[model samples]
Target: MKRVYNFNAGPAALPKQVLHRAQEELLDFQDTGMSVMELSHRSKEYEKVHQKAATLLQELLQIPNDYEILFMQGGASLQFSAIPLNFLPSDKTANYSLSGSWSEKALKEAQKIGSTHTSSTAKETGYSTIPSQLTLSTDAAYLHITSNNTIFGTQWWEFPSTPSYIPLIADMSSDILSRTINVEDFSLIYAGAQKNLGPSGVTVVIIKKELLEQCPSNIPTMLNYQTHAKNKSLYNTPPTFSIYMLSLVLDWVAEQGGIEAMERINKEKAELLYETIDQSEGFYIGHAEKDARSHMNVTFNLPSEELTSNFLIQAKEEGFVGLGGHRMVGGCRASIYNAVPLESCQALADFMKSFQAKNR
Candidate 1:
């Protein structure tokens, strides 16, 4: 079978070894004579899988003792409403920074739950860069920011130093485990497991114990973070297969030297691709500003939409897939998550150079 270097945004590339291991255990997981998918979520065999996944995540991110990691169903989109539901009360408001489509979706969900304020927004700039100045509310429930804008190819290189008392919440769906982060910097962090961790269906929520305490009882039991925390993510039939696959992915990450080593490789990959775009001399134009470019997702455009369309077609034929940009943004986007091999980036860069030479 010819395996193409996959570059889709989510349900993206996973470690080849993880896929192999999953296939090996698909028939019977650990002598149970049943696939993990067929096993009872409450069984001791599944319990061990859950525990090991959480423990490996803690070790990978160096999560402090005060944080509770809950693996729950529903993608990060669910957390958009869940965040405001659990954290933002009827009387108080939450602040949102509008950077891209996902952040806009998050803000819309917050508005449905309660009052929300746009602390800062880059909509006027066509979502090409991160807002320089953030106007935050002193008494807001939390300051929400999308750490990386996957669609627009913008990333917050460094988080704004907000007031210590004002808790920070981040939607890290795109670039969650790709780099080392000070886990204590945010009051809450949530990401879909599909991007950097594992497959789809499971969303990881890392919440400070204090923030969990703020969750009110009025909300649905499933939406409440504390409920998941207390139940150890067994509140319902958990996404057992997703969690098992995540365990293998996290193990692969540790084998590759953890997040620090990932950061080095990510930087090198982004630099190579961005440099190719910059030096193209009008043949290729990057959409995001240089300082604000995301190391995870790179968005760019060719001289014309016709050429851009042709480029994507040719790219796929060359074993490079998922190079089309989102509908909202009419261009090309290459998502280089942690699992994307650096050699793949080199291949893409070399292709870009040859494509430009022929087209220009």
Candidate 2:
């Protein structure tokens, strides 16, 4: 069966090779006579899959042994509360740079749990760019930032410089493994597996071991990072199938020359799409500023709302799904995650030019 050029944000495209390997392992994972889905989390077969995934992830991200990688449920959203619950006492405050909707939501969740402050926010600019000229508080419990804003199509090219004492927490849900990152920079990093990893059932949390000591014992057991870290992410029944699929995806990533290769191709793919929009003159307009543009999700708009609607219809006809921006900001968006092939971006760019030529 032919596959459409997938651009859906989360639960997005995974590598074709990974899919094939999963298919092969479905009936018998290492000749266990059972699918990984059917394997018990405690079983030796599943344990190996889980451990290998962790090891591959550590190698891919260059995560030091000081960091504890926990695969838990509840997506990255749950971490919004979990983060504040663990660190932010009601009397103290946590600082955030509100760059996009996700960070805004994270700030709100933190407020509900305890006091929170925004070092900076780009809401006044319609979230079109990352906020600059920030004032950060070193005394705050932690400084939270969304690494990439999927909806707004802006990304923090480089993190703001903060004191070593201030723990930097990042919501890397959308752009986690799409590029190479200095993992040591963060005190905590969390991402949903759906985007750059595998499916939606699991959320990966990487926390420096020292931060776990900061978590108060009053918080819920499941929300505490120390709980899962101590138990090796087996505190309860884990998302076995999702972790297995994630292992396969990591294997594909390593085989494809690791994250550096992914970054090179991802940069090229994004540039091709953005360059198409740039060359369109007045016909197509990009949403984010050039300096803050995101490589994973590209947002653009045609000359008119009518043309934007028409563009979606045409893109669909050309086997491009999930091009519609989002309900909040109605325009056009293309989420070109790691698994999105450069050929797909090229095809979409061609479609855009053709549509512009005919309509302009």
Candidate 3:
């Protein structure tokens, strides 16, 4: 089968080994007569797959024992509402850092729930930079930040500090498992599986036990973090096929030497593309500042709109895909996620150089 170099932002490229493994077991999983999709969620076979995925995640991230990993539906967007409904008490304010499109959406959702504050924003820079200094409040219930901004191609290389009493939370949907992080730094973390984890159907949440317990009981049962934590993320039918795929992806990550190794490779991939843009000498203009550049998604613009369109057309002809940017911001973006091989990045970089030589 011929596969083009995939660079789609979400529901992005997955490790080929993981896909192959799934294909091998799609007809019969673990000697069971049925596929994993057909297995009962409550059955021993499926539960083992579920638990193993969680375990591998914990091992890879080296997550603290106090954190609960809950695999839920609705992606990270659902958590935007669920987070405030569960943790934002009536008396406390939920402070958010408005970095890019996703953070803006999260902040908007929180505003509907209760008292909310924008501690910082990069709007003045057209969302091309992450806020260096945040206006945190001690009275805040929690400080929410999007660790990586996919649309603008920026990331928090160094996370912000908050008041000790205020919980620090992050939406790490695009960068989770792509790097090494101190799990103890954030009180809670949530990610949609579409990016670095596995597929689009499952969302993984890691909440400190204390924080999970503090979620008020009056919220809707499905929206409550406590319910999922208490029931081990099986309060209802979980996404079985997605979780199984996640397990295979996690296994592939381990075989590649866990988060640190992944981070190193990701940095190398990002640097190659960024270097290509930098060396283009005004042929390409990057969106984010150097310090805030994301290792996963690299966004840049050509000298003109016509040149950008021509670059994309030729890139596609040469078997490259997903080089277009998000709709909100029209440019070019190359999402080099964990599953993206360095060889693919190298090929793209070579293509970029060749394209510039011809077009310039």
lDDT of 2 by residue, 280-303 (tens): 996889999999999999998887
Q: How much does candidate 2 score in TM-score?
A: 0.99
By lDDT, the better pick of 2 and 3 is 3
Tens-digit per-residue lDDT, 1-360, candidate 3: 899999999999999999999999999999998899999999999999999999999999989899999999999999999999998988989999988999999999999999998999999999889986788766799999999999999999899977667889999999999999998899999999999999999999999999977878788999999999999999999999999999999999999999989999999999999999999998989999998999999999998999999999999999999999999899899999999999999999999999999989
Write down the lDDT of every candidate, Cα atoms only. 0.92, 0.92, 0.94
Pick out the ten consecutive residues of candidate 1 with the lowest summed lDDT. 158-167
Q: Please provide TM-scores, in order, for all candidate models, with all chains considered together.
A: 0.98, 0.99, 0.99
Residue runs of model 1 more than 4 Å from their true location after superposition: none
Report the Cα RMSD per candidate: 0.9, 0.9, 0.7
Candidate 1, residue 303: Cα displacement in angstroms equals 0.5
Error of 2 at 35 (Å): 0.5
lDDT of 1 by residue, 1-360 (tens): 888977888889998999999999999899999999999999999999999999999999999999999998889999999999998988888999998999999999999989889999989988889987888876688899999999999999888766776789999999988888999999899999888989999999999998888899989999999899999999889999999999999999999999999999999999999999999998889999988999999999999989999999999999998889988787899999999999999999999999999999
Off by over 4 Å in 2: none
